[model samples]
Target chain A: MKTAENAQLALLLEVAGTPKPGNVDRERDFPDLRFEHFLAGTVGAGPGLRAAEEGAPVGESFERAIAGMSQQEGGNTQFGALLLLVPLVKAASANENGDNGDAGGDAEDAPGRLSPEDVTRVVEATTTEDAADFFRAFDHADVYVDDPPEDAAELDVRRGSDAIPAVEERGVTLYDVLALGDDADDVAAEWTGGFERTFWAADRLAELAGSAPASATAAQVYLELLAREPDTLVAKQHGEKTAESVRVRAQEALEGGPEVVEAFAESLVADGVNPGTTADLTAAGLFVALTRGEVSV
Target chain B: MKTAENAQLALLLEVAGTPKPGNVDRERDFPDLRFEHFLAGTVGAGPGLRAAEEGAPVGESFERAIAGMSQQEGGNTQFGALLLLVPLVKAASANENGDNGDAGGDAEDAPGRLSPEDVTRVVEATTTEDAADFFRAFDHADVYVDDPPEDAAELDVRRGSDAIPAVEERGVTLYDVLALGDDADDVAAEWTGGFERTFWAADRLAELAGSAPASATAAQVYLELLAREPDTLVAKQHGEKTAESVRVRAQEALEGGPEVVEAFAESLVADGVNPGTTADLTAAGLFVALTRGEVSV
Candidate 1:
């Protein structure tokens, strides 16, 4: 329950951070999605977060979170964030239950912690039913996506529930589904490649904690993450070239100070260039930091 | 769990609503308390909310909520809000359990509803231990209050744990503790007066549910609430004449339009006249509307 609450707090903090270039924040909103929608999404996602904490399968919890999140007026607020959070939440809970040998002790006396290896084990254990549910969740999320690679069209998430048959026929577990997209999707890559970026961001957040307000720390982590990599959502929406340019801009903005960063944020929002994937990764990092007690409330 | 989530959401929504005169909202923050502090408080308050759902005693849950909420840097983000929420949450859960005869049927199939009488029962059943805990919660909350009335000096909340002896000596239940302050404190008045204002605000929120954005509806309800009565926090801080003048200004702002309301918000925040009690009442109303499903996610 503590893990679930922290995950929800991560979602709230992620959205509440100001000057989070090109994404919704307390100060900015996309035309169709306001700040309050994200607030509502955080509230709606609670049950699914609890499901993950209670040891439900990752894909089922993700689907449930997305379904609940869609109850808000906004079409999709935290789908990608939930994708990263569900497995992390499950792993944290599993660690608390002493599933990991190193985690042996009175669980109540020790804080829950997360490791890439623990999360990796969780994704690897996913069944084909989990893949089907993952696809079903896309129906509720209504997230923007480019056309799938021609070869993977049969497994495209845009197919929603219809893609379940192909997933089941191929016996593709949730991990398999993510593995197929590992080359192009940052979130999927995290699942397949040991969540290196998420952990790195978490470490950065821990280092920066208490130096500034929590929202500022989160915003800083977001900018640093964006500077480190081209945001996959931006790449999909615009092109690799545009995404790379955005990353360069983020790096320059970091050097140029708060005014420059604020300007960059405004420009991105004005141009409809939302670095949503970076935001999702930052949210995942926050959840990890919160669960590990690196970031105190 | 749903009831607890809604109550938490109510806290989030209460803080996120923009143009709320003299209170921390998305666009405004008091120097001592930033927007993120309230976010962290909402996260921190979760365990106590869950305690309420699990049927913890009202004062014990209230103390637990305050202890959790105090983990944030802000001194008192939702002290009075929790005062109203704890018993309401207990009552909502009790209704779900069919403690109220009219609440028959599968609890899962029916949304939980709150009634003044039901909440009154929850408060009236409180024990002296609950009263002691309620006083103890004030230590963690750090809320502002005027000196106690001359006759009730022994029962001052600022005495914190020290007042427990006095409370026990008098055999004062939590209800009795609240009843002592009912004449001056709007929050305490709700307890002894059967939550009339909370239910009325909930009905108003239900009436305004979909006419605008949820935050906007909340702001409207807040303005209506402020215009209807002089805010207790304002009265305590600036005296009755100033509080009544603020109320009159709120009424004028309502007739003067959004720009006028925005200006009034700025002026009140500038004067450091926080209508905190009004905000607390608004939060309680939001929780009631949310639990009853009158305000959809």
Candidate 2:
């Protein structure tokens, strides 16, 4: 429940976050998904995400959660967030699974010390059906992702669940779809790189959250991450230059300190720029922090 | 589930709401109860609040929910809000009890109408133990209700459950305690008068929530109500005149429209003037709206 609840709370905090620029906060909504949709989707995703604690397969949990999200009005309000969460949720619950015996060999660390290999194992375990469900989730939320390279085969997200048949015919696993996008998608990068950035951000969030309100801590962490790198979602939606500019603005705000961050938020919203990938990262970080008990659920 | 979820969601929305002046929003935390405490408290109270649908006595539901709230760090972050929500949540589920047969006599109000008389019935059903538990909840949350009237003789809230013997000796019910404060407390007034304002605000929230996000709609409703009259808690903490001035300021902001409302929010927070009772009202209104299926849960 901690894993699932933390993931849900992280998503809630991410959406409730103010002056978060372009992403849907309590004050704004995207044409594709209203704020309520995001909330509904997050809540809807709960039971599926928690199954990891009960030793459910990682792919199966992802499929259930994605199917649940699709039932909401928005096709994919938090697809990136969900993708980031699946591994974290599963990893957080990995220890509960370890109750049978020691799947964990690292006695130096605690029972569920998240290792890069575990992430790889979980990702590689995803089935073609999981791939299909991921594609089907697109029907519920039109999440921003780069167009496949011209050499890539047909895979329109708008096809809903129809594309699942093609994926199976091609024997393309969910990992294959994510591998193709890893170069341009932070979420996919998390999967491919053993969630390196998520672990790092989670550490960073742990250090920063103690001094501020959780939401404020989250916003600052988001701005810090945004300043560090251009958000991939922004780049996908509006070219790399625009994404860089958003990052530059964040960097500038950071240079001026916390007070400037609020002004930065207002201006970003005014300019219609959203550093969504960073927000997603913040959520991932929050998941990590929550799992580690650095932040309360 | 919607009843429990809506109740929990309403509490989350109330706490997450920011720039609404001096209330304990996500950005700020009261010394005794951090914002996270409220979130935890609300989530903690979920199961108990949902029992109303199972034909649980209103007092039983209230007692269970209050006990749940006490288990959280913030003993009384939402004491008034929970008090307001108890009957409202139960009333929202009132129709479910009708599954066996129809107890709903008012068809004009629709499928699940929360009537004043129903609220009264719920409050009237409380036993001295319920009164005892209510006092115990104070140990968890130090809600700001006025001191017992001079004529009421030993009705101290600080007595914890220890005062239940006195309460029983006096034969004073929970309804009697609420009735004692109805003249000066909006929540108590709702209990005594059949929740007229809650229903009215619910209607307003339904109208406004259509065009705006739920939190924004809730904020506007809070301001509208605040503008109309002084908040009882604000009046208790900072005197009636100060409360009236806060209402006047809200009214002034209303005169200038939405943009001014934002500025008014800054000033209110700056002045440390919080219309908590009205915020409580908005939360109640949201509960009614959510329960009625007028607002998304």
Candidate 3:
């Protein structure tokens, strides 16, 4: 029972990670919610819903596949696009101290408890760029382990990629992007074009960074590029790349300027990305990455 | 988000329908514990982990699948198995009114918040039998709906059966017990034989019963016959009559006293059925069906 109780908390903290002010203490109480069990049940029944939405399968095996996975661990955990963000969840709850919690132990074996102060520091240390870094690095690392090192730069990416085919199959798109089929190039080309014309040329220049900013902000570069090729495959790639770039640039810009982080985040809000969504944050990271030349499109 | 949150809580409360006293209100904080996202994750992952340990396709797909489900809407909620019993959990936090502040609202609403008083009531109201009934009924019910009814007797069995095929495929023994194949007859025979030996033949029953008072008190008489002859197959011609007889016997015994309930449950326990496992719980339910003449063992 002690294990069961603790297991509940462990899972919730794992998913919710850290808590921000105004948000629930995700890691603290979320496990007590039993959200996964509910998902298993709903999703287990969702095939019927899926059957109703899409026509029923000719045989039971299709439905069985979904159900077969249901009670299987993480059967109902698929969050489509949100899944990519899950790798950073542990980092959110992880105590930076890496202490083992024994007074008799050496400094290396100190307790790893995250105090409210630690929570504040970690939250402060975390940024959109960090999150993107998490995604990029997470794909290449063993994010799941008994004692995942705090600074393991390279993880078993092959192993991580091998675990979730959907990540590859979907190719970052929330839908069945991997199943683009024979017309993959055509569909990719068109979406790419739309991405360039709509989000890049228009949204970026007009709303994000203006054509002529005070300095060569990554956001400014993003705006300029979109202006050059409004409707092209390159634009779409640039758009996503630009967001990633902006995040990186912004973090660098904010170094030693503690006050600027909040402002930069708010600017992202003005640009229409939900701070909660990964794309917007990625864009913020792109800023820092572009400025530092750490990543280029 | 609200509905998702509520659904998460509902799932937890459902799973933790009944818990022992001190077990519900845990003292530890969330990150301080080790939570299993898949309550059945360990059990479900059992095969996968074993397979991995044995050098099988320790592929990321299986583990990824489990991890995905770990953050499922219901997974991150506060209501996991023993986790919900924690007094601080919002689901268990109630107002002056006895309402689990958030329970009856849609899954979109917060989970009917359970107050300490409400938690106490829920804990008191729930028995192992009640918990089993909840799962069986949940098995039959449509989990996608916003609010699952509180009354287990009112659940739709046919719809519940819809989930059966999928559960069968997953081999989730808890909800899939009724789905045994050719070997079911053999297993059923063994179960019945064990029941007869443990309950019907035991003359020192009173002594055993008195010794384990908690166990003895909740034992139901009809549950005894259920313990002995679950899954007894009767010919179609005699099936209805047999089922009716069992039902009559059950109703009459239920009318006798709580002691009958105690006796029934005690005998089953003495037979060594752990209610935590879905297979055992379902088997017990089968016992009830047979004893009540609902089905032939």
Off by over 4 Å in 3: A1-7, A10-118, A126-297, B1-181, B185-259, B270-297
Ranking by TM-score: 1, 2, 3
Per-residue lDDT over B1-297 for candidate 3, one digit per residue giving the tens place of the 0 to 100 score: 121222223223223321111111111112211222323222222222222223222122123223323432223212112111111121222322234543454542333322223333333332323223323333321222222224322232234444444444443332123112113232222222322222231222232333422112113322333334432232122343553444444455456655664453344334332222122222222222222222210
Number of the top lDDT candidate: 1
RMSD of 3: 24.7
Candidate 2, B3-113: lDDT as tens digits: 666776777666655546667765566665566666556655655676765667655676677766665545566777888888777666764454323365666445565
Candidate scoring better on lDDT of 1 and 3: 1
lDDT of 1 by residue, B1-297 (tens): 277878888999889888899999988877779888898888778888889988999999999999989887778999999999999999899888877544445543343557887788899899999999999998887889877779889999999999999999989899988887888899999999888889889999999998877777888999999999999999999999999999999999999999999999999988889999999999999999988888865
Q: What residue pairs are clashing in model 1?
A: none
TM-scores of chain A across the candidates, in order, are 0.95, 0.88, 0.23
Which ranges of candidate 1 are over 4 A from the true structure?
A: A96-98, A101-113, A146-153, B96-98, B101-113, B148-153
**What is the per-residue lDDT of model 1 for residues A121-196, given as tens digits with 9 covering 90 to 100?**
8988999999999999988878887677688899988999999989998899999988887888899999999988
Whichever of 1 and 2 has more lDDT, that candidate is: 1
Residue B232 error, candidate 1, Å? 1.3
Residue-level lDDT of model 3, residues A1-297, one tens digit each, is 111112222223222322111111212222222333333333233222223213222112122222422432322332211121121122122332242122354442234421223222322333333323323433422222222123322222224334234343323321122112112121222222222221232233234332322112333333333223221222233354644555554545345243454454445434433212222222322322222223221
Name the 10 consecutive residues with the lowest summed lDDT in model 2 chain B. Answer: B95-104
